[model samples]
Target: MNLVRSELLKIRTTSTWWWLAIAAFLSIALAFAFNAWVANETLNGNAEELGVTGDQASAAAQAANLYTSGQYLGLMFVMLIGILMVTNEFFHQTATTTFLATPRRTSVILSKLVAASLLGIGFWLVTTLIDLAAGAVFLSANGHGTLLGEWAVQRALLLNLLAYAIWTVLGIGIGTLITNQLGAVITAAVLYLVGTQVVGLLFMLLSNLLNSEAVVKWQVIWPAIASTVMVSEGQTDFTPAWWVGALVLIGYAVVSGVAGVLITRRRDIS
Candidate 1:
């Protein structure tokens, strides 16, 4: 309990958290702007021309998209928050003092995990609220009306929160595994922002070349798509079951976290 409290206090005392808050707000604003543009295109009869017709331009669809936009775009920042939560300790050489206080490496790591998860939840909640408020104003302004009460929208929002929470834990694992702050942050950014998409695209091309449906279904990206699609209930042919996606994500967290814990236990602090 004390270790967790100390971890929380470290976050509270830092400027990094404040910077992340600002970044989140800015990210939400960008989401609102993007959604508003889409809404306006639909209102102006340009939706079909822009490939946003039928169910794609529906209130529920728009709302769901808007609600989850933060998760889609702002996820890197949230992940960075998680990564930095631990990496910063190492960067400043404060891990030695932290370990001295706690003595047990597992307890310290667990406390960091708890702290990162809490920060992830907090980040999601704040960004979601911003998304809702901004979406409502823009949606209603464009005559689409606020669709916050829609079941699809509600479900997407909830799942988005869950995804953000999971991503944070994943960030903590990455941070712990790679203690070099810059290297960890860069690796995370590349993996999420570029690597995942590139890998998915390559898999898709390979699937096309090989003519294999199974390959597409079982690829690394499918689980991620499945998780989002399951929540939004979006029409897609390739996504796996929601539970399967959840398990895949959990698998990532567990693997990274366990590896980090083992390394931390074995490595010298000096």
Candidate 2:
């Protein structure tokens, strides 16, 4: 009970959580706004130009696309929450006392992982809801699509939430492994924005040149690819299957978490 209370209190008293929430909100809102405008403009033009019918259904679909948008942007917040939650304990030298009191190191790390994941997912859900509401209103006002009676749109929104949760869990695992605030942040950023992307691009280029099928499979290297599952209906460019992407993501998280657990058990807090 005290542990839970302390965890909750730590989240509340810190600016890190607040900043992450704000960033999530901004990411979703900005993406929705920008996409809405683009959709509106596209709908106003001839269907042949944008390769879509300028109709109510089109508008609604576009709005939903806008709402499910911005996974790349929102991921930064996930990383922030995950890394900070784990790394802050080390920064404050609180891990020593925490481990001494808790004794069961696994439980301690699990608590922090759950707390960070929840914090990240909660913020993402809130932002997604906001985008949904705003997007519905915008589409209705523009006569692009009906706000209600659109089951597909709703499904897209739900998928967006699910993707965010997956990303958050991945971040939590990375946070656990790094444990140092700055180091974790850098690692997360590099893995997300730089490392996987650069590697994926290189593989794609090489695959094109060599006509080697294996090079195209680099999509499974990071869950970052699944970030697009929310939007891009029907199908998308070459990427790993959704389930494969999810597993790859989960694999990374599990590996990092297990490493953290082993490290925590072996390290002397004192």
Candidate 3:
């Protein structure tokens, strides 16, 4: 209990978490606004192309405004937060003190994981509310105001939150195992940014060059591929089923976390 309290204290006192939260909130807000704007523009263009004017075009635009922009920005922020959650300990030399104080390395690591997960969940909840509210307002302004049921919205929001939180915890595990701030940070960044996209492209290219349909479709089994599949809206025709994606991601998180624990327990922290 004390160890948990200590971990929470460290998290609360740090400025990094606050900065990340602010950045996440702002980024989600901007993405939603941009998506809304683009939606309105496209709808208007379509309306003009079809020779439809006024309220009809506005209504069409509103309906088209339900995009996945909020998820994109929120995920980016999640990556940043995940990187810091692990790296910050090294940057501040907190790990040494934490281990020395706690002695039981597993306890310390578990405490940190719990703290990070809670923080990630809290941040996601707040940002989701803002994202949904802002999206609704923007859509309503354009004359397409179809309010989603509270329960459905809440469920979607929770799924999003879980997805991000799991990723962050997985990152924490990576950080613990590596113990080098730079390496862990880079890995987390790559996982979120470059890793998945690179795999997706390579798979597509290989499929084109080799004329192999199975290879192209099966490539989504990679960790990066699976992560993308999990986050995408409503499973595109090319993407894996949502349950497969979810299971793959969970597998990655579990394997990485266990590996981290084993490494941390055996390592000489000094």
Per-model lDDT: 0.74, 0.67, 0.64
Candidate closer to the true structure by lDDT (higher is better), 1 or 2: 1
Whose TM-score is greatest here?
1
lDDT score for candidate 2 against the true structure = 0.67
Model 1 off-target regions past 4 Å? 39-57, 142-144, 211-231, 238-244
Candidate 1 residue lDDT tens string, 1-270:
778788889889989889878877877777777876776776677878867755556778777777666565566776788789889888999989888977889888888888877888888888877778777877788677898878878877877777777777778888888889999999888777686677678878888998876676565443345445545544433455445666776677688678767877887897
* lDDT score, candidate 2, position 37: 66
| Tens digit of per-residue lDDT, candidate 2, span 132-235 | 67876777787655544666566666666666665665666666667778888877887777876787788789889988767676665656765663343433
TM-score of each: 0.85, 0.81, 0.78
List where candidate 2 sits over 4 angstroms from the true fold. Answer: 41-61, 146-151, 211-217, 240-244
Error in Å for residue 70 of model 3: 3.9
In model 1, what lDDT does residue 170 have? Answer: 75
RMSD of each: 2.9, 3.7, 5.2
Expressed as tens digits, the lDDT of each residue in 20-75 for candidate 3 is: 77777677667777766656775657656644344434443333234334555456
Q: Give candidate 3's whole-model lDDT.
A: 0.64
Please count the clashing residue pairs in each candidate, in the order shown: 0, 0, 0
Model 3: how far residue 21 lies from native, Å: 2.4
